[model samples]
Target: GGPRTQLEYRYVGYAPQTVEVGNRTMIDVSLEQETNELESVVVVGYGEQKKATLTGAVATIDMQDIKTPSPNLSNSLQGKIAGVISVQSSGEPGYDNSTFTIRGIGSFVNTSSNAPLIIVDGVQREDVNSFNTGIFNNIDPEDISSISLLKDASATAVYGAKGANGVLIITTKRGVTGQPRLTIKVESGVTNFTKTPELLNGVDYMTLYNEARRNAGQSETYSPRDILLTRSGLDPYMYPNVDWIDEVYKSFSSVTNAHLNVTGGSEKVRYYVSASFYDQEGQYKVKKMNGYNPNLSYRRYDFR
Candidate 1:
């Protein structure tokens, strides 16, 4: 024996390999390692921190969880985050920004400050509401990569006064090192009311009204003949029984959305481009004097 030789080497990676040769063994070995979930980095107020090291309360919204179509990005956050309440105050065309509150209502004194601070790409915005008319639309949801809600004082203290109501950090998608990729998505559908109130017809409405009037010690406004005339579709011009609810609401409204995205880049330079169009028609149809009926329609064009 050549003075007993021993050698050892250690490496951390996937799989393990070993080889021995002659008396002086030469060995090659590899060790597998597990990923530490705590090491995952998350966007915080002013900076990023590892999830495991963060002591503040935070909640992340999964983009996949947003399946419904919405005019404003805030509307998509409904029921997606825990301890966060998102409410669409109105569905009016181009003015549908959902109100969001973190950890419940923090202040009733100032309604303006009740909303969480929205930070997009490190820039702070008062709220997602759009004032320029048209369904409070701002920021295309397709461009969003991640949304993190910063709760608790520890995480929001970095933002000073702005963070008192909490903070929402929105990160847009970035190009990665790979071949150029193009994605086009098209969605078209109709929206119908989930539930409609049971309404009375002309005769039934008159009957109920007359009964109520009689109970209140008043004379009946509609006679039996009047009810029959309104019910029969013949004297509409004189004794009209309009179904206001049916006339105001449609059976279904159309919605169409299309988005195109292109992304590619190298280590030095990366780029992401996206274009989208959204068109939605409201259920309410208004007839113009020019014999044209137009539904409350909203159209939005987005480019990034």
Candidate 2:
């Protein structure tokens, strides 16, 4: 029954009512962003350290940002942080070890161990590859509580010898000091490859073969005219085009992962145990190859 303005302003206080009128009048409303002092904490070695005390540059990859579809853990980190380069290198199953480097190329030699030192929990591992690729590749990247990369010499000095290249510290899930907590994670999807290469047809392949023989001064090795007549007009099945890459690659792949975690405890005895199951079949049969560490000897073809 009253003015339209009164109806809109009836439920709100003066501040909100003013904001509504400003919008109706096309006036810009600006306010300073407020930050919480209690929320500003830097992640140090074991726990959160105040951000103000941090001396060296440390970048962290937290859980919420990582809880997405990432087939390779290394691929998840690509271009997400400054000064960190993660390369998938190869997609072969067991060998899908991602190589990481900080800043740029710091070593003179290409084959030199240019990988950053990887530390898990409180222990330092010789190589990130020391663990099975299957273990790290399939697990939820979100399971990682935090991944802190230490780049400067000041940050690298603590571990000494192994820290020469750089340092990467990884923290896994831990118990919280509250009521028993449960986390159920589930992901289902399909993956496939595209843009494959083409192969030569029977006629073209024979033409190339004949030309090679003629150039090698073996004119009689291939009867070009007869070869063309025999293959040119035949069904494709009679002269099958074998696309090796396609023959070895699979057209369809799917994965399903589910995990359940339980944790909660007092200061003295805290415990965490999680069991996960992962099954992945590749386009290639020898998807994962763990070759001989060191070959004892090489035998001739039938000499064994």
Candidate 3:
């Protein structure tokens, strides 16, 4: 042999090749280097759509967002979605309903049913006012898988008759492809009036009354013993400068809720079973009000 020779290679990617001379042995492997980015797809009513493909003006509320600071389903939707308005007509416990509208006023003369249609898990839920006795509690927000509102006519045309007003499509939780998944959610918090009114004290009340009397030029030194006693603090119980509103209202009301969900299975039969317990009290009112709502739900989904 004349002299020994050495070969060197410099490259960024694999390229299989062979350098041969008189007699030599070599093996090479070429592999395509790739960078892949994974994405999630959400299924709307009619077809499958990527999150980015949505352009028809829609709002999505998921389960995790429901189980947060506020347990009120109607409160959760307040100002969260664009072009949607939720007005809570009353502050009474267990009596809150949201009036949902789409793209301002769709009808010029029809105000009877100005609200958008509400569909829960493919079941139409109209005439909610008829059931406003507070007998039925709303769907547990924690149990909701997703809430999608169809805002424009183009998105609402699929459901035709029901979509004339608008669409509020609610899909409940379901099972995934895995072992049985269990989710436990618990929330406890106080409920207080946003702004409580202030009533006049007894002294102020008498002062106002006497001032009115003076203004009217009635100079009869009106001395109702009850008023005199109240001014003198003679009988605190009988003429107490009591805050009747505070006396009737609680220092703070409370609500506690707990729910458990069991889900998951194979391809054939996937199921979701959930139960919840809720106890809530009123914020500000003359009488005390509390509620207990125990719910059980079962759903079987077939992937056909």
Candidate 4:
């Protein structure tokens, strides 16, 4: 047996356990907690129940379910969640969030129609009608932990009249019991016009116009010499052959997204914090005046 007075066992937030004069082979010790602390628990508007036992029509999705490069969280929800009808009115960077509905439109009133109640961390967010940033929709997708869609009345009874349309609950990531963990994610890509209208330059336009005139039994409007001059690009002022699309558009625009996060905590204090950035360049090629170019871009930064 070893001496009992020379050893001490200490654990943070818990009372120390001392093994005094043990058998030297095996010992059992239970360390009591010095302080009580709150732990993580799942709580819906009402109470939580197993999926098999759930009575209301509620849908849930985890981070893996709606993961995408899109900064707009709503954009990634389309086609991924059941009973969710997601529609995007525009593809513009900041305006790309989908205007979604749960179980389709429930009201015919224009102002209140089709808009589901958005709740983040148990607080209701304002209903948004415009393309501007939606409080819940603009949340960093990586910062989100889970989302729930309360489709039927039974599941959303607690929300009362506000839940007439439906309810969407978003919960952000929080700290867990572990050592501090750092994570970094980066994404970069380009976007190009999928399709564009075919247009004719000066020479082709004149040739086609002259052919049409000839088919109508009329004289040629543009002389062959003028057409040749336009094709030769000799005098842009008098016979300009300009392709506006080639002038207005570039090959592609850039899109970038990044996220960095750290999560760590002791049993009594757990925390999750993250920062993210999203930037999208416009497709239009703007001309520079002097040395400065007025380029178009959309940028969003999020910290949680």
Best-performing candidate as measured by TM-score: 4
* Per-candidate TM-score against the hidden true structure: 0.78, 0.65, 0.70, 0.80
What's the ranking of the predictions by lDDT, best on top? 4, 1, 3, 2
Candidate 2 CA-lDDT value: 0.58
- State the TM-score for model 1: 0.78
lDDT per residue, candidate 3, 228-284, as tens digits?
788888889877888877876667777777778888989988888888766766544
lDDT of 2 by residue, 113-206 (tens): 7767767677765554334544344445645678787777766677777777677777787777767777677767665665667777656777
Candidate RMSDs in Å, in order, are 13.1, 11.2, 15.9, 15.9
Candidate 3 residues lying further than 4 Å off, grouped into runs, are: 1-42, 51-55, 69-72, 105-112, 127-137, 224-228, 236-240, 283-304
Better of 2 and 3 by lDDT: 3
Candidate 2, which segments miss by more than 4 Å at Cα? 1-39, 108-112, 129-140, 203-248, 266-270, 285-304
Clashing pairs in 2: none
2 against 4, candidate with superior TM-score? 4
Worst 10 residues of 1 by lDDT: 128-137
Candidate 1 local accuracy as lDDT? 0.76
- Give the higher-lDDT candidate: 2 or 4: 4
lDDT of 4: 0.77
